[model samples]
Target: MASWAEVEADAPEFAAAVRRLLDAHRHKTLATLRRDGSPRISGTEAQFRDGELWFGGMWLSRKALDLRRDPRFALHSASVDPDDDDPAAWPGDAKLSGRVEEITDPARVSEVNKDAPPGPSHLFRADITEVVLTKVGSPADHLLIQWWREGKGLRVFKRT
Candidate 1:
């Protein structure tokens, strides 16, 4: 596993590229497993906070229900680069495998809500467990985790 130090001590260009992709996209399509073992997908507004993806919404929404049923979820953020818009153009995508937690603290909600673009509802946070750069074709497949220590590139905290 890559250490925090190694991921931090990465090439500036590569790091900036990753940040650009994450910042450019605000909407993520989250997938969860339904009670019957089916897949559910919904679009959500997300923010990168403290190196983790945070999302908020009405507690009664279908997406929220799915998360409540099964915390294991996947998020995908994607878009076309301004200069190109072809299938082969290879726009970047970030996939995160994590569990969702409903944060009920008004103070904490206010803090997270500040950075989130004005939206239609309340907010909750998700603590990312694993992330993959699908656009670059899975960094793990191309480079050893030990080679660059990709683990610490994005630090996430799970709710206790």
Candidate 2:
């Protein structure tokens, strides 16, 4: 796993594209493993701060509990419909998968929550295992998919 900063250092172009998609919206869909091993999807907000991707939720929330038990998670960026008449206008979509370390330090948590509503919360930092972006191709009949994983750098695949 690698920090977002590490990813940027390793693959600047890929990292920049992913960051663009992530910054295009404020909320994302997060998937976590439930106690029974089923998948749970929830709305979440993430921040890129201090060279890492961070997220938090209300204390003891189901999503928070899930992360505490099993840190594995996948976050999908907000999506936008493509302009069928102009595929190039599509901004694209991105997904990130990683493991999280719960933040227990009061000082760090306080800093993370400075802009948030006052209340107890759970916070975590992610170590990314994979990142992906998908966008409509100019030809309109194809899709361009790009992904990066630890050790593998970046790879692209197209679907027609």
Candidate 3:
């Protein structure tokens, strides 16, 4: 697993591209495992802060509870339909998969979220296991995928 900073250090261009796609929108989809081993999809917001990827959940919200029980998660950036006339211009979408460690230290939480309300909440930092960015090819005839895995480093491939 690696921190966001570590990924950037290893692959600056790839990390920057992924960050751009992720930051282009506000809302994202998060997938977490339910107690029954089923999957739960929830709306979420995430951030790249202080060399780490961070996210939060409401006080004891289902998503929060799910993470507390099982740290594994997949976060997907919001996407818009590609223009039929110019699919090549699409900015594409990014997906991050990792395990999260709950941050329970009051001081650390305050530092990350200065505007944190006076109530219970959950703050998590990601230990990234994989990062993927998918988009249309320049000519719009194929798909481009750039990915980074914890041990495999970076890989780029195309699908026709």
Candidate 4:
């Protein structure tokens, strides 16, 4: 697994692009593994802080509980539909997958975010395994997909 900081260190420009897409909207989609090993999608938000990607939830939320049982997760940035006449102008979308480790130390939580809930909550930091971004090529004739994986660095490909 790689920290978001590590991804940045390995691919600064690509990482920046991913971060911009993620922060472009207020809400994101989080996929967690349920007890049956099925996936559960939840509405959540992620932030880049202290060089890592952090996400959390309200106290005892189902998403939180799922993470407690299984740390594996995938997060997708909120996406906007492209105008039919200007698909090439679309900013594209980003998604990542990783396992999160809980943050329980009060001091660490406070250091991560000063606004952490005063009461119970579940906070986690992602140890990302992979990151991907997809977009329509400038001329709108093809699709461009860029991805980075732990130990594999970054790669890009285009498709018609």
Candidate 5:
């Protein structure tokens, strides 16, 4: 298999597509692995800033504890209307493969929250590993999405 950089280089547009989707969508359904090896999914809003994806939750939430033990997570987002026929085609929707890190520093967490308050907000910083954009082909393959990811940031990928 090729390296992460190699994969990202081969599909530059995919990365752009993911960024666009993120900008349009405000909510995401995060799927995490439980200690028992099962999967748990929950809906939450997200904010992307400073090259990281930030998510807030209650400290006692199951998703919070799940990420504490296992940071890996998958996110799914969908357009507000599946039948809409406007530009930005499917509106905002995507699947993201990433890992989460608990934001414990009061200042940093506060920064992540910004207008939103800290405490009761369990923040996680998602380092996007891979991103998939679905729905593009024919009706049979109406969900032909593209995926891309780099080991580092966009600047590094541009150099490589």
Candidate 6:
């Protein structure tokens, strides 16, 4: 697994595109594994701070519990509908998969919650395994799919 900083260092351009997609929206869809191994999708907010991607949930929330039991997770950037006739206008979408490292330090948690509502929370830092971005290519039917995995750098695969 790699930190967001590692991706940026290894592939600046790809990382920049990913940052754009992720920063374009405030909320993302996070998929976690349930006890039976089924996928559970939950709405989540992510923040890039101190050179890391951080996220959290209200204390004891189902999603938080799921992460505690199974740290692996996939986070999808919020997407917007594109202009069908002009694929180039599409804002594109991104996905990040990794294991989460729960933050339990009181000082760290307090720092993270400084602007949050008054309530207990569960905070975590992401250790990314893969990052992917899919965008409409020149042809309306084609997609420019780019992905980066630890030690693999950036790769592209197009499909119609």
Q: Pick the candidate with the highest TM-score.
A: 3
TM-scores, all candidates, are 0.63, 0.96, 0.97, 0.96, 0.73, 0.96
Residue 70 lDDT in model 3? 97
lDDT of 1 by residue, 17-49 (tens): 554666677777778788898998888877756
Candidate 6, residue 83: the lDDT equals: 83
The sequence of per-residue lDDT tens digits that candidate 6 reaches over residues 41-129 is: 99999988877899999899989999999999999999999986787889799999999999999899888757777768899999999
Q: Judged by lDDT against the true structure, how good is candidate 5?
A: 0.67
Off by over 4 Å in 6: none
Displacement of the residue 155 alpha carbon in candidate 5, Å? 19
Q: Lowest lDDT 10-mer window, candidate 1?
A: 139-148
What's the TM for model 4? 0.96
Q: For every model in order, what is the number of clashing pairs?
A: 3, 0, 0, 0, 0, 0
lDDT of each: 0.58, 0.92, 0.93, 0.94, 0.67, 0.92
TM-score of 2: 0.96
How far off is residue 16 in model 5, in Å? 3.7
Clashing pairs in 3: none
Worst 10 residues of 3 by lDDT: 112-121
Error of 1 at 4 (Å): 11
- Model 3 Cα shift for residue 58 (angstroms): 0.4
User: Can you list the residue pairs that collide in candidate 5?
Assistant: none
Model 2 segments beyond 4 Å from truth? none
Task: Give the per-residue lDDT of model 3 (tens digit) for 1-160.
Answer: 8999999998899999999988988899999999998999999989999899999998899999999999999999999999999999999999999999999998999899776678878999999999999999978999999999997899999999
> Per-residue alpha-carbon lDDT of model 5 for 42-155, expressed as tens digits?
987877666556787787799988999999888887456655454235543677777887888988877678877544668887766767666544433345545565554332
